[model samples]
Target: MPESTPFHDLAAFIALPRVSSLALSPDGTRLVTAVQELSSDRTRFIGALWEVDPSGERPARRLTRSGRGESAPGFLPDGTLLFLSSRPAADPGEGADDKQEAALWSLPAEGGEASQLLVRAGGIDGYATATAAARIALAAGLLPGAADAEQDERLREARRKAKVSAILHESVPVRYWDHDLGPAVPHVFGVPDAGAEPSVMVDCGARRIGGSGHIAVSPDGSLIAYTAALGTLPDEIRDAVVVVDAATGKQLRVLEAPDAEFGAAAFTPDSRHLVCVRERRITWDSPGDVTLWLADATDDQDPGRDLLPAFEQWPGAPVVSPVPGEDGTPVVWFTADEGGHAPVFRLSTGSGDIVRLTTSGAYSDVVASPDGATLYALRSAVDSPPAPVRLDAAASGQEPVTLPSPGQPAALPGSLTEVHTTAEDGTALRAWLVLPQDARPDTPAPLLLWVHGGPQTSWNAWHWRWSPWVAAAAGYAVLLPDPALSTGYGQHMHERGWAHWGGASYQDVLALTDAALRRDDLDGERTAMMGGSYGGYMANWIATHTDRFKAIVTHASLWNMYSFAQVTDFPAYWMRRQGDPLENTERYERESPHLRAANITTPMLVIHGDKDYRVPIGEGLALWNDLARFEVPAKFLYFPDEGHWITKPNNIRLWYATVLGFLAHHVLGEQWQRPDLV
Candidate 1:
């Protein structure tokens, strides 16, 4: 290990600067990234903007500073940098609130102090900028029955004075993943220019809810495309792309189908066409599919053309190239999970041909240059943190040039390798094996089988919350696998575990673990397993099925299938997959981990957050009670003010410390010791 690296220190690892997003200038001469770090008090992570040389020559430099920090970096046509901040206005009379919501701010390209550009009564949730038309669109919240800004403010003040926190709902989705909806509806507004007040472009209607899923403005700035809910019921609440006149806010077209959901809209450079992701809705027996679709902006009647009908992998957000092909066809680029790697690919609108631009690592926040010859993105893998990289958009199987990044992570204390195996159904499964630096054949490292969340998601990119390096640094070999329901393996792989979450997925996970344990550097005897969310559910399931491991750590996991399906933030979504528990009791009885709680012999640690509506606090309380009833060794770590994922710096530090301590006690045969400041 390098002497300068602090991989062994938990404090240093938690305090390391983390990058979340990237934005390239319209001219592609400059790139900006959002780097988050522990605040002065080390209570939370705050973000600031940093500039990087697109040419990868000069080192990166900080561009903005504030106690509240800045984020959502964007570039206007005039080269001015735009961002969102809650910082007070320079002038006290500007009506700046010290505890105010986030507002739009601008910093000149030539270098100067950033100033407030636009402020809304509800602040700005998100914004999009148009380079060619020099326009900005913002997503803001508005109170019901309020038609304008003044009315909106009056409504807010009235509600506060009345000490009311109630929201009446007429829709099925009364609550989202973490919070209740209503009281204030979301709308999209068109800001005439910087420092100018915005005008409401779309009301989004009360029933529409959740505002727009993904918003995009045409290059010519004449039209705007966004995603909106199609209906109010849970199953009927499908998303569709809606295009409207930018200035008048008159609806022009609605692109949708009975069985397809559309989102992540992007307009072509010429503004003649639009491309968005089309996902086929899943059913009881069949898994859904995702592909790209090209829609004609001029004619609303056209159903649009499929761009990659035969592509097996599910693509991420679509980004249209600024430059067209030689035949005047628009070019689109997107990143997708293939095997264990997430790479960038180019799709020709004319030929419907796909070209892979990158071969390894995961790429996101893709930005294309004006000429479409070069692409910029943030790339990361299991062994690396996110860093800016530039790649040839037209190249095949090429590596990207790493750009100068600010506050890059310290070198790892260990290395990563790939482990592959064949499932019972003859399907190939793979996982990343992270081995500690000191592991040898005679003295093997203790194995930590860490399952990933998003049962539908793959372990293709770097993650801050569930980082495997922390375990590896603690001298445990971590196995990150993508089982049956994991993406990137095509539709059939997902179908195998569609409604049967505990069947093939569980077997595949065990199969991959069997393969990894066969390696000489890993100790099969001194092993433990851990997971969060869906992975947490699996840990509980594994405990019930087998005692192969000595300990298990389950975080924000689902324990009771019937209750979880009905009480989760998205009850309808889960019900759609598992069917109504009242009617489908057999599936729930057979798969739910709680049903076999008596079979769990492995000592376990349960972690959950009170604010996590996704899994809910009730699930954690019930799991703890069940463990106590069954006489299984258990401890419950509860957070009073956190969501599905722990975000606060101190909270995250404690999470890592506690998990490490738990594993050390059970797997390393050490005395149980509590993490400090718990």
Candidate 2:
């Protein structure tokens, strides 16, 4: 028999290098990517920038290293590689401490040691550079009432000296994701010269929440476009694109709509237009829709024109061609979820024509060559980890050539196939099945049914957090299904499960699971179900509604729909879909899994991260308590430091170990040996 792969061993899997984020130089001669690997202590993943040969010939080379690591690689106009890091500056000034914030650092094109380019008291959140100019625009936090960096630094110092960690909120949301939204709010700053101090370009004020707003710089270094929440009413909160004069830090125009949310701006190479994402806000009667729009970067009054009025799939961040097409019309490149894959697409701004450039795999961070002949992006799929790939800019349905990368995983211990079925209502369902190599007609592998989160997202891309290959290595067939509300299937898919999370969505999963079990390589008699977030919520629903699965694993899940609506970081978003619990309790009462917890008979493994503001800890705690109240066989795995997802290397190792152990005992009928240091 073939030996098991890295997915079979927790330590080995955790040590595997992961690559993400792609950056192409202005000249298109260099391709850089951020690679994360297990740190020396094996406690965390350290990120470092690596250079990938654009020609796909030379081996990738590491560009920088430090204990604190580096990320968000962007090339300057002069070929300097810029990144964000918290490492101590080479020349520390007064009050510099061992614990430093993430500052801007740059390495010369000729290659040498990196030097700090800019540092702030609150640290730089993210930054973007002008393509044709040396102008740099960054996002940083400014404490309330602070006019400049000096005052901001003084406020931070005073707060540190006083040991005050409090954040006063005057807005609706006080927290976002895993962190508090502030005593400090994000502001866009512009640095026109190499040594000049960054001037505040746009003060986001109390309207902004979470980390930092998305910022984009015009190619000519003349304009800056960013995302910010507008309007004063809490219920009417909508994000709008704010375009500003990069030189004067003056507001030029705000692109917004009464019922739409816009952000993720990409300026055309000519710096005359902007390509951005626009999502219509969800309402009680209808679901939201996402599409691309073209706007005049300088002055367009109305909410621009829809570039994808007829396109079904929602496009991701746009990457305008550095040079116009052969016909002299500007072209935009982007990736959009289509069927079971995310394909790169080419869009013409002049004719409103869109064409698929890639046939398979999910693509991200796509950048066009300076000559507009090639495209570079990071591509991954259900059976593959992310890797750098080069693609033809204008080709249709062409396969991308994988470039030399350090993130290649070992050969899988199994093979991948597809499963398809039709829901009760005639809606077609699809899934990816990872089948162990040893499984045969007489000796079928026990199945593990894995549901995807987002309820609005598809199971098309590679996900390190919930990779099915790991389970496949353990002699199981993992089924990943795209149920109702899954993207890429057009507007009707979302409408199917709108506010009916447990109805059609649940049935779609069951239909796909049933179809997968029909395969000779899968064992229907011994199966388990698992999910996180919305997937977790589905797991809970399945547990209460049926006992088909031998075991179930739910993480960062929702237990009580009414309570979840109130506690989630973005209450309005959920309320918009679920409605006010007090005013309309029918849906909340009918869908809440906690209310039906007594029906659970299958053994369960409950996982939750305390810092997850999206679902919050109460859901997990309540689910655990309900399980205990009903004397259900279950185990609760909690991570205090993790939020939404388990990020720490050690925590992830433990997470996988415990989960696999639980599955082994329940599905395979093996005695469970507790993972070490549990």
Candidate 3:
């Protein structure tokens, strides 16, 4: 058989054919999941919907009974299941590509033939539709039409089927946060519920929610409030909550976000008001605060009250919570960064009184159910994986109900050890080291110090990836560090590397290496580094600054701020974070690894998606040219039809295959097939 792919690899995992979705039933007693399954013999794989009575003691039962059809499952408040199913893409396996043709289906909770709820010619994303609320909301994607690629398609197909012609008129669309089907194309809005048909209240126009967007309904059903983009992502835009007319899709008023960003806002159970978490995003220093916005439905213009400045940062802890009052007007029931812990807090919206809920050292994203009777919170930690906690939150006020892992739990290697070490500047850098189970201190196994890309991001709290997992399975130790900039800790800790690109920030990984050397489980002689985006930048930095590693793999990396400022998708953002390269030209030179290509002596494999606008592939190409000119060991890997992320199963398989082989050969000192070598 082909080499036993590790559990972490996409082929092994996606190959399992399972679905993962979170949908709550109308009564909240039943939860639905969209799962895919393979026949017992393992030849055929099927995608279908399944429901489990969270309150019952039974296995989940299948809901959808169709062909290779069904995915993106959601729950409607009235007890119906809404989902998207794979339909015939005019181009066959193009799947949900150009046609965007997945038929939206709604099936009764009791069960029956699924009915098509909404079927448009094209354009849709994971959607939101009310069960009995009479409104549906979906993101509209940018459609690529016949105006551009018809000639190429016609010529290519003419040589094949002879009859196959390019019939492309309009294709896929760019999906965004807000859209109202009533106004048609180009216009979008926040969803509304007027007891009549649902409409949009806030317009997205060309704006997008760089992350996730949530729409909230008032308990009274007379008003609607939704998270909306006030700016464009070219600037990496932030969003705000707006009060909207439930019937006309009209924006009554918009709550001005105090910080550059705000998130996951929710209304009180009574629906007369809402509370939002405000956060500034200019630097690593986050000023996390909670602000309340109110609208009485009758008072249109002055719906918002004075911004309540009630809480401050709690170090090492982050809680996700928004309270719509249990019985009275909605108060700002939230969690704060109080005394270095993210315990749940019940703060009175009217009086600003703070009450501590959970004293646990970690927790986040807490949400109370519609009736204010149940609260679901996702608890987190640096080394601890995330688990759900359901609280009565009211009387009896019982303990929390912990949620189970998504599908099957990640098969973490038994050798994994959580450790903390001191960086060059004495900052504490934490890491999760996974050594082979049989690895002995004398074995000297190769090390793969996997730097999480965010620089502002992190790899922690149950880190699972197909790439690193396979690397570990191949006899390499994977070091995952939440260096700095990783949230969970207060903003101060995350902002540790604000503008210090390769300064102290770069030394942390090396320091982590020093720490690993002290550990008997790791092999200090053979080591390699890999990461994407910001992590990619650091891989280049380490490769150039030190000749210690045997090999390196960098993906979607930014090589030069000078060129990157102009070519990247987030131009304004780079300028904001790094200061205009035009002004701080010298800093860009000092920060970029490209300036010292001659110094990098490690065997390197560079990969990039050609269509990735985030960290443009030009940076990768530039590095490849420099490495070749300097006779430094290197090769360039490119994916033509991909974005910052590789989505197509074929590309994903190919991409990881290359990295796996590269590391196996260089770091593990084992002969593995790799195109880079060829």
Q: Compute each candidate's TM-score over C-alphas.
A: 0.97, 0.98, 0.77
The residue pairs found clashing in candidate 1 are none
Summarize candidate 2's per-residue lDDT along 1-678 as a digit string, tens digits. Answer: 857788878788888899999889888999999999988889989999999999989999999889999999998899999999999987787767575699998999999899989888889888999988988888888899898888888899999999999887777777788876788887787778555654434343223752236788898898888888886666677888888888877888888888998888889878888888888899877788988888888785655798888898878878888888667767888888878899998998778888898888999888888888999999999889999999988889799899998997577889988999998888888888888889899889999999999878899998889988788888889999999989888888889898688998999999999899888877899999999999999999999999999999999999999889998998887888788887988789889998998899999999999999999999999999999999988999999999999999889888988999999999999998998888
lDDT of 3 by residue, 27-70 (tens): 66666665655544444456777665454356557776665558
Output the TM-score of candidate 2.
Answer: 0.98
Angstrom error of the Cα, residue 243, model 3: value is 2.8
Q: Which regions in candidate 3 have their CA more than 4 angstroms from the true location?
A: 1-10, 17-19, 36-48, 65-72, 85-98, 126-186, 189-213, 231-238, 257-259, 283-371, 375-406, 424-426, 461-467, 675-678
Off by over 4 Å in 1: 1-5, 93-95, 199-212
Clashes of each: 0, 0, 20
lDDT, ranked from best to worst: 2, 1, 3
* Error in Å for residue 625 of model 2: 0.4
Candidate 2 off by > 4 Å: 198-207, 210-212, 326-328
